[model samples]
Target: MTMKWKGWALATGALAFSATAMAAPPSAEMISFACAGCHGTNGGSAGLTMPSLASQSKTAIVDAMKKFKSGERPSTVMGRLAKGYTDADFDAMATFFSKQKFHPTTQAVNAAKVKKGEALQEANCSRCHLEDGKEGKDDTPVMASQWLPYLQMQMDLYQSGARKMPEKMAEKVKPLSKEDLDALLHFYASVK
Candidate 1:
């Protein structure tokens, strides 16, 4: 082959290799290192207050990080941490956690409580959290398979006006009755 043709072939091969490298999956070690402090080794969080990241959607995870960076989602610690991440870093982290499988909760939920919870979740949560409470878009956390105690506490915070979220969210939950809260908690706790 002529020199110019050989050069062209080399360039094409290099481009293909670069694309393949970019598409490779992120390493487990990198994911673990980034999440160890709050989410523990297996995606179970260190405390009840922190949400588990395992089994969460890649889209939801990235969206939350974007919200934190933009100051739309209000969390002092998360905002600060998200600010330092580049778009590429956020994508990598989201991809990493989305692949981790979550362990099932062993605690049993009461039947009456579950009935009430289902009603509350259907009325107030379905819009954003989706019918199964597993799919959420644009910075909303998935409630399906989430820790029940953690979910309950967040709801209480929202109801008591202790947790400040987007204005629309506060407005949505403002009218939730006590029965509604109980029902919502039960419904989410029972979801796999």
Candidate 2:
């Protein structure tokens, strides 16, 4: 092809790429004022009931918001709040939080608890959560750096039917002893 023709084609491609990038949605900070009280500025929550959004998958975050807004996933607090969010707000929030790194905590974990948790995780949880519990695929959220209290609360919820989970997950965790549950929570929470 002629040099002039090639130059024109390159220029056209660059312009199209720039336009697409510029059209991409803004970050969560634009709409986070509504969520900051419970979810914190970076998606880490002080409340045990609130799950951290740092490093969470964008699709998962968006889906959860949809569920909350629809009343399919029941949350007294989130349901009411989510109802007020637009699709654009949800997308921007998800995109923003997904890009943030998790804040590491300095909480001390019991050595014995950590050891037992590691063993229990390897035996029962590793298949799904993998070695770090952060290497998730698809809908699974990263659990490696999750808060201990939140982990425990979720397990209890799953066991008691508070958190509606899939049949497979419910079935797998149905037989866990109290100690096993404690160990699993400790192991996951201790991971950096």
What is the per-residue lDDT of model 1 for residues 92-164, given as tens digits with 9 covering 90 to 100?
7877777677534544667897887777767666778775676645566667766668787777666666556
Worst 10 residues of 2 by lDDT: 18-27
**lDDT tens readout by residue for model 2, 1-192:** 456855675777754655554443545676865576777768766665567787777877888889889887756788888888898899888878778786455455777988998888887767767656765445667777677877777777667766687666666667888887787778887887
lDDT of 2 at 96: 80
Which 10-residue span in candidate 1 carries the lowest summed lDDT? 15-24
Query: What's the number of clashes in each of the models?
Result: 3, 0
The Cα error of candidate 2 at residue 130, in Å, is 3.8
User: Over 4 Å off in model 1, which ranges?
Assistant: 1-32, 108-110, 135-140, 156-175
Alpha carbon lDDT of each predicted model: 0.70, 0.73
Give all TM-scores, in the order shown: 0.66, 0.74
* Candidate 2 residue runs with Cα over 4 Å from true position: 1-27, 46-49
lDDT of 2: 0.73
Clashing residue pairs for model 1: 116-183, 117-183, 117-184
